[model samples]
Target: MFSTGQMIFAGLFVIAFATAIFITYQKDKKLHAKNYKGAVWVAVAFFVFIAILFAIKYTLKN
Candidate 1:
């Protein structure tokens, strides 16, 4: 187990990292909107394909 110092340092590091990422994403929001417009549909298709595979596997197991 880590001492109090390590834990505190890790917590602070996570907070700072997350904040930086959020700020970067905010700055890139406009560019993302322009370039990655069809991302949602791609994600949906990927999830649907995985679900179908699982359904087939489950059906075969019975």
Candidate 2:
């Protein structure tokens, strides 16, 4: 069980950590767009590959 002080510290820590991450992401937004232009297609391909693997497994299991 957490004490009142530990709970307060955890709440403050989460707020500070999230604020830091948001600020960092905003700072790098432009660089990320330029560097990761084709990233969506890569994600799509990964999903499709996984689907194919699942289909093969299903067929073999039956």
Candidate 3:
């Protein structure tokens, strides 16, 4: 079983990853001003990439 601290750390990592994606999407949207779809896909890909990383980390840890 994972410890409470480990769980919290994982949650924080996910949140930070999401926040970073959101910030990047916002910046790209503002900068490009016409490629909202591309920005959204980029954000989605980023989040998925982070999730995959987390999954791999957890799998290795266990």
Candidate 4:
């Protein structure tokens, strides 16, 4: 039941979420090489951002 604009927005949101995950993974790889702890926090923050994006999208639809 979504309009074209809504669908496009949702797709873009998903892309953004995926990009965040990719960036986090790359950072994790570098951090792992350096033996840093920030990678865990980066992953946590990425998921939180994705969750927030989903919440906003659903809220808009409802």
Query: Positional deviation of 19 in candidate 1, in angstroms?
Result: 0.5
As a whole number from 0 to 100, the lDDT of residue 6 in candidate 3 is: 100
User: Candidate 4, which ten residues in sequence have the lowest lDDT sum?
Assistant: 30-39
Better-scoring candidate (TM-score), 1 or 3: 1
Q: Clashing residue pairs, candidate 1?
A: none
Write down the TM-score of every candidate. 0.92, 0.91, 0.47, 0.46
Summed backbone clashes in each candidate are: 0, 0, 0, 0
Candidate 4: which stretches are off by over 4 Å?
30-62
Question: Per-prediction RMSD in angstroms?
Answer: 0.8, 0.8, 12.9, 13.3
The best candidate by TM-score is 1
Candidates arranged by TM-score, highest first: 1, 2, 3, 4
Better of 2 and 4 by TM-score: 2
lDDT of 4 by residue, 1-62 (tens): 89999999999999999999999999788667688767788999999999999999999999
Give the CA lDDT, 0 to 100, for residue 34 in model 4.
Answer: 81
lDDT by residue for model 2 (1-62), tens: 99999999999999999999999999999999999999999999999999999999999999
Quote the lDDT for 59 in model 3. Answer: 100
- Model 4 CA RMSD to the hidden true structure, in angstroms: 13.3
The true-versus-predicted C-alpha distance at residue 56 of model 1, in Å, is 1.0
User: lDDT, candidate 1, residue 25?
Assistant: 100
Where's the lowest-lDDT run of ten residues in candidate 1? 1-10
